[model samples]
Target: MRLVLVRHGQTDANVRRELDSVPPGAPLNELGLAQADAAGERLATHPVTSVHASRATRAQQTAAPIAAAHGLDVTVHDGVHEVFVGDLEGRSDREAREHFDTVYAAWWTGDLDAHLPGGESAHDLRARYLPVVERITDGVHGDVVLVSHGAAIRLAAAALLGDTAETLYVPNTGLVVLVADPAAPSGWALDHWDSAVPVPGDVTAGGTPR
Candidate 1:
């Protein structure tokens, strides 16, 4: 099985550096639509068999063009949703850094048990996300595209890719390709991390992927 992990396009909250993690999340901005289109075009040769995305509006929108390219419908997966921020939801980045320092630090440190007071722990995220990833990789024979959020993708990459995760930074609409390897402990092998799109120029200037 081959997997393509894509980060959702930019959102309004992304430009503002605000934390938007709840349902529906934020809608894509103008550039985000273009980015999604470019991403679909980039995957033209992949022969994607299925397209999946988080329930968030941003992720769903990002998945649309890619799914259309393959004549596939975008399947919304709750397991791939963004990490819930709890009290930090809708708050500015500056505020979150100052108030949620411990939780944020723990996440960067790869502590599976770390989380904000009302949010999900790293272990919680894995329990929900990894199973979905494994199920798809195990069941699918052809390539599959999974459009998910920034932090969630980061966590999963860290756990699945190990050393390679250090350089696997997921930019907005950026792509990561992985292939199944039974001999690997993680049951997958990193083919590429944060692969570039064939788009001529950068689609995101002020916004970040989420």
Candidate 2:
């Protein structure tokens, strides 16, 4: 199976560098909508059989255009949501950097056990997210696209690649493609990690990276 993990378009929280995991709301801003549309146009060439997104509005909005083009409804999965920031949710970057020193340090260093103030730990995020990924892989018979948060997608890529979390910090709207062969021990191989704004092209337009 080919799994394409895509980070959602930028949100107000992203622009302001705040942590936001509020559910069913926080819709995309104008720039975010444009980004989503661009992403969707690029994805239109792929043989995507399924589209999945976090229940968060940002993710849903990101996936909507693709789903509409493909005539598929996005399957909302709660497990794919961004890590809960809890008390730190609405804080400005400067505020968080000042008050949540330990958490910020841990995040910068990719410590999975590090917990945000009153929020979920990176370990906690992996525990929930990995299983959902497994389920998605198991159920889908072909290529799949998953629209999710920046942190969640980064951590998920880390888990899948058997790398440190620090090794997988993807930018907003980043795309990571992985090919999984259920018969192999490791089962999955990283195909590419591309961040260039995807342009309209034939499915075979881009070459695989070495």
Best by lDDT: 1
Residue 138 lDDT (model 1): 69
Tens-digit lDDT track of model 1 for 73-105: 998887888877687878776657465556755
CA lDDT, every prediction?
Answer: 0.76, 0.71
| Each model's backbone clash number | 0, 0
For model 1, the superposed segments whose C-alpha errors exceed 4 Å read 100-102, 162-167, 195-209
RMSD of 2: 7.0
Which regions of candidate 2 deviate over 4 angstroms?
A: 98-110, 164-166, 182-185, 196-210
TM-score of each: 0.87, 0.83
lDDT per residue as tens, model 2, 62-115: 999888878999999978887776787666555664545565347547677887
TM-score of 2: 0.83
